[model samples]
Target: MTQESATVDPPGDELFARVPTEVSVYEVSPRDGLQNESTLISLEGKRRLINALVAAGLRRIEVTSFVSPKWVPQLADAEELARVLRAPEGITFSALCPNARGLERALSAGLSEIAVFLSASEAHNKANINKTIADTLAVFSEIVPPAREAGLLVRAYVSTVWGCPYEGAVDPARVVKIAEKLLDLGCYQISLGDTIGVGNPRQTREIVRRFLDVMPPERFALHMHDTRGTALANVLTALEMGVRDFDASVGGVGGCPYAPGAAGNLATEDLVFMLQSMGISTGIDLDKLIEAGNVAEQVIGRALPGKVHKAGPFRLRRSPTRAS
Candidate 1:
């Protein structure tokens, strides 16, 4: 472990004015985290991982994607996985639905929540979904309405909001427009993704600033990859801007097959530690989350890139308190 020190600020400092008191951390490890890994995760292995995440107090978990096995071989058993009762009551399990077929699978699997995704870049959109941005929206329009009508909550993911792998930088306004359309299509929330993990704090503030102009921060979440190692910093910037909901993967194990060089999602343990240390509530037990990360590391068969999971939480021993 490395030694570090910080000057403790007085409680309720002015700098904390704009920060949120409580935040929602969305866990995406079982779905996005394991999607692109080279190692194939078995059904039982995935169940154990999900159980660990639930035990760590993650309420919103994306368990799997409803896509075809030909596309994502890792989650070939999405139907069976979806039926498993890993979490207790009130635990929201979501899955990514790419098209009508995927949406049908989600519906048949008895899922109450599903998410649809599209890239902000036309090239990446085409490469990922094999459809232009316009066509992807068209598909969403067709499927999102039916999914909503079926009494399921729908969420939207707008990838490459900051920068793209195929296309360098995306205009924030363009991303906002896509978000608006998805919302109009009945998505209750939108998740802005830094697919290539190329976002900085300044850029995050500016982009989120623009989104706030049109949509309330409560209706959106930030799904950041640690590819450029700025996911946590970018998240801090968002938190300072009153954004609460964030998507994180336990142990930071995820990547995009469509977007080359993209890293895993922000580590769940790191996000929880930072928020809890700053007096913001994430409602996650850091120790148990680290254990969950260990489960992820074992499942992935490699040492992950999560800092807090590797170093453990900061615990200092002091003499017993003296009586007043």
Candidate 2:
């Protein structure tokens, strides 16, 4: 095999004994990463970022959201951006649409895959979308079926599955019910989000364990934030539970407008680096992934919170006495 095609085995077999051989990384950088940026990113800049992510071998990317421009002006160019997207073969490009209006916009843009979002907590639901949890689900029920009938793949996000900024310690049962409802509403996959990043490994394990009883691991994905610095640990806990899909942002650049003091999503480079080091294939090039993160950093005009983007990959250092 060519050097680039060859796999790098994990340093120790025992460390990765329970880890899966492959994992699907859903890239949310173009959508979730930029939605909350203080400065507006030009269409050219957004296109450049998406191109870099595709070049890094990301097969699934959330390109943009069709939410009202009044709420998130950073993504006001969603329709225009959609028109300019250049997705190659084997790439699945998706956009988040809050309701029927947003879905109609996505369909008009020629997108066949779309994402819907609601929070597990009532307070977040009301705060985020200005609707109660029940009201939001009602809207989704109206939107999801029509989208599916139009030959679109529908995915749903249940935010604040672990804890809510306004309401602490979310009930696991509530998350399960929300996920079941989403699946019943014709969502092909459901992403459980630690929106405020208050979850730890123990909480993640318990959450996964609860969900696994009602659905297969493939039916669920994890969307974690690094606000508490335990995002990777939570991922490791999920990996051990056989959950293979994860949602990550490039350079960890986005946070919720409703979630006060919340950090960005888990950095894609950090997750890819850990997965690769543990002998798990993500079908993404670590070097190229870092390059994408760098591009995102440049677009945002600041250093990101991702460690790998700043420190680079880990390497063994030779002793001072060794030959130069």
Candidate 3:
């Protein structure tokens, strides 16, 4: 055998541990990240970005939200975007559906996966969707069955799972209850979102521990914002607890329009870097992910919050030739 063939790859072994070091990264830049931006990306631009992401090996992508154009003008082309989305085989393209109307639109647009959002805190749900938590639950009951009937995979977004900007600290029990309801309503996975980025490792572990009591860790996903710079720390806590699915935006390009003072979701580039450093296998090409972030910045006409986008990945230089 050649010398190179004799050397075993240690990094592959590290990724094989029972605990998943590399979690699935859901790129939401096209949908959630762009929804709140002031600049409008054209239908063609959205398609170009999505195609690029798929080409870069992103299998799960949030393409758009099926909501009122009057409310979110950025995603006004949701139908067209979803219809023309040319994703690779086995690649899942999902959209955020607010209600039955939105679900109908998503079905018409040919999406097989749809995500529904509800807030744990009353004030947040009210501000975000103009409905109380109780009212939102009533809507979910109607929304879920029809979606399942249409042969779509339903994922739920439980927002403000940690601290809410308006309500301060949220009760873990409330988040758990909402998650159970969404799951009972036929959502295969519940994405717990720290809408305002106020959660730290301690709070994240506590909440995740509680959720583990009711649901398997694999059935849950974490969505964090870096408004307070604690998103990666919270992600580490979740990873240590055996949670493996995460939601992130390229270039950290999202914030809550309803939750004032909230920053963007944890950047995909930052998350991938942390996971890969620990010898995890996310199946994502880091360099391509960073390139996607650059495209996002250009589309939004502003700098993204992701540090990696600002600084290139760490590399060591070779020794320079000296005068012999």
lDDT of each: 0.90, 0.92, 0.87
**TM-score of every prediction relative to native:** 0.92, 0.93, 0.92
TM-score of 1: 0.92
Q: For each predicted model, how many residue pairs clash, with residues at least 3 apart or on different chains?
A: 0, 0, 1
Q: What TM-score does prediction 2 earn?
A: 0.93
Which segments of model 1 are wrong by more than 4 Å? 1-14, 317-324
lDDT of 1 by residue, 1-324 (tens): 233455565475564578899999999999999988877888889999999988888899999999889999988999999987544788899999989999989998998899999999998898888999999999999999999999989999999898988779899999989999999999999999998888999999999999899989999999998887898899988988889999999998887787778767788998899999989987788999999999988988999989999999987878599678
For model 2, give the 10-residue run with minimal summed lDDT: 9-18
Worst 10 residues of 1 by lDDT: 1-10
Model 2 bad stretches (over 4 Å):
1-17, 316-320
Q: 1 or 3, which is superior by TM-score?
A: 1
lDDT at position 142, candidate 3: 98
lDDT measured at residue 319 in model 3 versus the true structure, 0 to 100: 65
